[model samples]
Target chain A: MTPALAVRGATKRFGAVLALDGVDLAVFPGEVLALLGDNGAGKSTLIKCISGVHRLDSGSIEMGGVAVTMGSPAAARALGIETVYQDLALFDNLDPVANFYAGREIAGPRWLPRGLRLLRRRDMSRATGELLTRLQVGIADPHATVGLMSGGQRQAIAVARAAAFASKVVILDEPTAALGLRESRRVLDLILRLREEGHAVIVISHAMDHVIEIADRAAVLRRGRKVGEMRPTPDNRQAIVSLIVGGDS
Target chain B: MTTGQAERAAPLSPATGTGRTRLAALAQRHGAALVLVLVVLLGSLTFGSSFTGAGNLGAIALDASYLLLVATGMTFVILSGGIDLSVGSVLALSGVLAAYGSRWGTAGAVLLPLAVCGLIGLVNGLLIGRARLAPFVVTLATLLFARGLAFAVTQEGNQVYIIPADLALTRIGQANVLGVGVPVLIALAVFVAAGVVLNRTRFGLRVFAAGNGDGHAAELMGLPVARIRVRVYVLSSLLAGLAGVLIAAQTTSGLPTLGEGRELEAIAAVVIGGTLLTGGAGSLGGTLAGVLLLKVIQNLINQVGTLSSAYQQVVSGTFLVLVVLVQATLARRRRQ
Candidate 1:
């Protein structure tokens, strides 16, 4: 089967600094790929390139065996690639359903006879509820504003929005960095659930334990270059940390 | 039962506490409108003859129509996290242009100001939204420029061109529909339309998001942030210009200094109506109520016959300060 996403020889330069240097990565269907790195490890740069926030200096990206050029976030979304940034980029005043359907809205007829156009609030809310349920999110109501929710609930809403709309690949940037242990475990479980749903998940995280928990494969980056890929097995954390810190190849 | 058993049997009831919290929130949100209504009722009871009369109410509503129109547009601009200090000057300029063009007919009077004001708005939007300039500074410059143009067109404020009495232009200001003033009806229609646009459309959501943040996320969501910003300024200026046109029609002449300080009143009404100066949230309904509240206060002061009209200004200024202080406190609480 074709890989869900492939980035080969991706290079990005910002003025005099090299953010990413010839990085190669692949995410297959139904797999969680943990992108492990420290600060300045070029993890964010790679995600930006894949998510179409920035153009690659030199490289190619392929989705479902077709080469694609992502010039904007909208373009990436059109290709079934979604990114949940660290901020989660949600409107706090609006409810979960509004946040989920912020840009994407369902329109139906105004009246039965002529039916011009109107928002399908019921359908959208139902879909939002189903997505939250599938992720085991314990939301009181989909109509509740996100500001009233806990941090973990907000994170869950973000992930559910991505998983619901993302047809193939979902990139989560530090999904649990600010969360407590219990909330972090909930997010990890949600990641595994995404994998089970057949999505190619890319998790950019600094926590080794989190990277080890739900990731099927781990790619270590140091100084804008990918150094090694490790299987999700015993002794993977130490090996990945060493690779991240410029230890043995 | 034992003491421990009795303690265990009395579970905490959070539902009542939650209900109280919700009621407090609603009161906080609607406090301004409620206070305004109470003040109006109190003034009516105290003033007796003048305050509660239908004719006086009609006059107050008619007098408020222009400011209401201007404030409605101001609400949108503020909600988008921006300001338009040039609106008063635009009103004067549009008034001068309408009077000058009145010789041609009603269409000339209406279209000329709209086109010119819209162009000014477009410029303001391009400068602020596309060039990413500070809105206050940009609009301040436009304010000066528009005022200068108004004076230059009227030959340094010496000319007062009057529209012919028999022309259709006269009806815009003087005409009444079903015993209500045309300008009043127009203001009401504008408010209703704006309410729909701000609440029911995807464009409205984007406006809220843009005001709430730097709009980068809005752009990511495929919203045309720059275009929306431009459209708001254009809409604001157009509304101001329309107000100017109506005023000129009503008076049958344009006064170069007609709209001086009107921008402040418009801003006051918008803020008093509950729109945050920092942007992100507002309501057209609140703005209408705010305009009427200010007018009612002025009318009540007039009825006293002992207080100067300046007292009205003093009262409004005090109210503005208090409301802003309360809003700031509430916003801080929400953030916490």
Candidate 2:
């Protein structure tokens, strides 16, 4: 089957340093792809290129088999490519529903009267509550401010933010970086939920254990090159780590 | 606010707080309104019926009208985590422009100041929002620039353009409805409109998000961050311009120093209204209450008969500092 999202010959550079050298990757729907790499291994650069943060010097990204330039972040979002960065990009002072629908908030008339559109509060809140519950994320109040949530809860919301609108791909960068053990497990569950719902999820994580727990496929990068691809099972964790570190051919 | 504070507060967004914490948050949000109520009660008891008298209350409302107008715009700008220091100068410039335009008729008088002041605000917005300059620094520069332009127009403060009492402009500013001053009515209208726009509209959510969310993240979310920033500044300046026209009509002359330091007063009102100076969390409701509270206090001081008028600033400054300190402590607790 054609991949939900595909990247081919993705080459990026910062001055003289090659951040991503002809890196090719793809993910099918209903599958989790974990990007495994050590620091400065072109993981974030690849994500940025795919998510439209930076223009690729030489590469092409496709959503559902159509070549997309992704000229801007908005363009990427329009193509159903949502990236939840490590920071989560949420407004702490606002409620969960507000953060979940910050930019693409449900407003009146079904035809937004531009900036003058009024929000449909009940609709947004109901949608948010349902999304959280579907992932089994324990957020009891949709009106509660984001600043009052736990790490795991925040991660869940960020995942939901990406997955809810993402018809093509959801990219998560370092989702579990700040989460605790239970929170990390919750995030893993959320990833599986997204995959089960037939969304393509790409998680960039340093935690090999997490990648092993949820990822259907693992792609390791070393020195900006695609080094290895494997199905990370309990026994193959050591082999994945070795590939990530460029330990052997 | 720092990104660190924002990140730390992020996970805590779903605040299922205890009753006590909820009460504290409520108090923090509506503290300005509560204080306004308490002050009104005390003033009424102290001055007896005079404090609540229609005549006395009417005067206070009228006095607060110009301030309320300016504070309405300030509320939006602040909600986006920005400051507009040029408001005072823009008010002065607008007054001068209106007085000058009065010769042509009411339309000219009203539209000229709005046009010029709106242009100034647009420039302020572009500079700070699109150019990515420091809001404080950019607005401070504009304050000087606007003041200079106002003086240049007035021939170094020597020329005072006068508005004849019979003119349409004067009538609009000077006339009353139901025994209330026209400015008061206009201010009330502005408050209603602004309250709706700030709370119920999609643009309003963007203002809060821009102030409260990670800037990069907000951009990725498809919010027109630069455009929103520019619009808030524009709104603030336009409102200040309108306030100037009304005030000029009341005085019947454009005084170069008409609204000197008025921007600070407006900022003080916004802060006391429970709007965070750092942006992200605020309401126009709190701003109205803050303006009333300050005006009422000044009125009470006037009634004191023994105290000097200078005490007005003293009290205002003290309230500003106290409110800020309380907010700082609360924010710290939330971060922790």
Candidate 3:
């Protein structure tokens, strides 16, 4: 099967700082690729380039074997790339259903027959409910404002939105960094479920356990360059940490 | 670890507490409108014959009708986390243009202001949204520019153009359908349309999202955040222009000084309507109630007849302060 997302020779610079230097990455469908790095290790810059938040200084990205150039975030989304940032980027005043359907509304004309032109509230609610259920999210009401949700539930909703919309790749930046243990586990399970459903997932995380728990392959970054890649099996944590910090395996 | 994982994986209860919370949130969101309605009813009962009288009610509605139009447009601007200080000056300028255009025909009278004021809004939106300028400062500059244009067109406040009597544009401001003033009816229509667009459409969703954050994420989500911002200002200016034309028609003339302080009134109504001045959460219904509530208070003050009409500004200013204080308090509590 084709890799869901591929980045080659990606470089990014902000002012005088070279945030990412000649980084290359590939995320295969049905796989979770964890991007691990310490502070200022260029994880964010790499992901920004992939998600079209920032244009790469020099690099190319391909989605499902097609060369893709992301001029804007919308351009990236058109090619089935979705990013759930650390903030979750949800409207607090709006309910889950509203947030889920924010930009991607199902619209019809006012003069059209009752069900034709208007947003089908019932359909939206039902679809949202089903999506939440599949993710094992504990959101009982799809109409609950996201602001009222706990941090973990909000993360779940964000993840669910990306999974629902993105047909190819989902980039999650520190999804569970702020959550409690129970919530973090739920997010991890959700990540696993995404991979099982044949979506490419790139998880940017600092937590070793989170990476080991859900990631199939781990890529470490140190000082803006890819240090090494390792299979995140149970026994590989120490070696991975050594490579990340000490610079050689 | 496996046992712990199994225990943790046990399906959690789906948001069982969400129903009650949802109801509470709805009430909180609409609380201001409910309060305004109750205050109106109480004021009518307390004022007895004066408040309930048709003449008094009509006067209140008529006065509110134009402000309602301006406020409706401002609602979109404020909801998108931007301000349009130019609305007041735009109102004055549009009124002058409408009066001038009334010489040709009613269509010219109506369409001219819309085109001009909408251009002003479009400029404001482009500068703030696309150029990434601060909304407050950009609109403030436009406000001055619009005011200067108004003064220049009226020859430094020396000219007052009288609208022709036979012009249909005058009828929109003067005539009544079913005993309701046409301006009020138009305002009501605009309000209804605004409410539907804000609550039931994709564009409305994007507005809410843009308001909620720095707008970058919404842009990334394939939303045309800049375009939406531009459209919001255009809608705002169009409404202001419409209201200006109605005012000119009602008076049969346009005064360069007519809408000098109206922007404050419009902003007050929007804020009192339960929209956060900081942006991202507001309603057209709340704004309607807010306009009515302000008008009712002004009407009551007039019925007292002893108090000066200037107290209207004082009362509105006080209400604004109180509502903002309440909002800040609520926001602080939520944060904590």
TM-score of each: 0.92, 0.95, 0.93
DockQ of model 3, rounded to 2 decimals? 0.37
Clashing pairs in 3: A108-A117, A109-A117, A138-B15, A140-B15
Q: Higher-lDDT candidate among 2 and 3?
A: 2
Candidate 3 per-residue lDDT over residues B1-336, each given as its tens digit: 111111110011111123444343344355566777787788778888788888778888999999999998898898888888989999999999988888778888888878999899989989988898998899899899988988888899888888998887776689988778888988888887776667656666677778875775576576788988998998888888888898999998888887888888899988887778877776676777788888888888777788999997788788888888776766665544
The sequence of per-residue lDDT tens digits that candidate 1 reaches over residues B154-247 is 9998888888888887976898888788889988888777765566555665566677566766666555678789978998999999899988
- State each model's CA lDDT, in order: 0.81, 0.85, 0.81
Error of 1 at B130 (Å): 1.8
Scoring each candidate complex against the real one, what DockQ results? 0.31, 0.50, 0.37
Q: Which model, 1 or 3, shows the larger DockQ?
A: 3
Candidate 2 chain B weakest ten by summed lDDT:
B1-10
- Per-residue lDDT of candidate 2, residues A98-123 (tens digit): 88877887788756566677778788
lDDT of 3: 0.81
Return the candidate ranking by TM-score, descending: 2, 3, 1
Question: How much is A131 displaced in model 3, in angstroms?
Answer: 0.7
Separately for all candidates shown, the number of backbone clashes (residues 3 or more apart, or on different chains) is 0, 11, 4
lDDT of 1 by residue, A124-243 (tens): 778877888778888765544576678998898888888888999999999999899999888899889989989999999988888877899999888899988998566766777788
For model 3 chain B, where is the 10-residue window of minimal lDDT? B5-14
The sequence of per-residue lDDT tens digits that candidate 3 reaches over residues A138-215 is 874554457767898899999999999889899999998999999999999998999989899999988888898889
